[model samples]
Target: MYCKHCRQVMDNDFCPDCRKATRMPEADDICFLAERGHPWSDILCDVLKQEGIPFLRQSNLGHGLMSMIGQGLELESIYVNWKDWERAVDVAAGLFSEDVEILWDEEDELQE
Candidate 1:
């Protein structure tokens, strides 16, 4: 398998490229779970780390520039492998509980 985070070929559950876990459940693959402005993104990342879920935080450089240019691009998002999507979501939901809102209104637009 390949690591969803670094796109490197993985020999096992742990990615040698990024040195993170790669065996995420397929059902928990909630790519682009939250936007950049949402506080939940950071919180969920932390929670995922604490729960041992492999995830990645991605942001569009253009979006950052747009934000500075007053165009206000969409927020950055969190992503996980297709395998890990549901478990990751569950972990986030368990951690954040009622605070788990759809921060990314744009849906799954993240690039792999």
Candidate 2:
């Protein structure tokens, strides 16, 4: 398949040129979108849901700490399948430009 982000001919599931998965992504192929605390995460999640973009909301804190301190207090990370990444990003950008913390440089790690 061809990469949606970068129209490169793909040899494997992931595009060699763009380093983005061109096929159906697995759990390991999920791409990080942003990190936020409490209501912000909830708001973004709701927007993603409304846009029909599948996503995963995970707490950055350890499970024990999250449980003890409460989910609201800990930072939450948003991840999305490679296929829906562009759309999810657009949604996030439209909603929160400055506050959304996206680790742009770290996206290269997904290629590995």
User: What's each prediction's TM-score?
Assistant: 0.45, 0.57
lDDT of 2 by residue, 14-84 (tens): 78777878864443356778889987898889779768888898888998888898877889889887678
The candidate that wins on lDDT is 2
Question: How many residue pairs clash in model 2?
Answer: 0
How far off is residue 39 in model 2, in Å?
0.7
RMSD of 1: 11.9
Q: What's the distance in Å from true for residue 14, model 2?
A: 15
Question: Model 1 — which ten-residue stretch has the worst lDDT?
Answer: 103-112
CA error at residue 80 for candidate 2, angstroms: 0.4
Q: Best candidate per TM-score, number?
A: 2
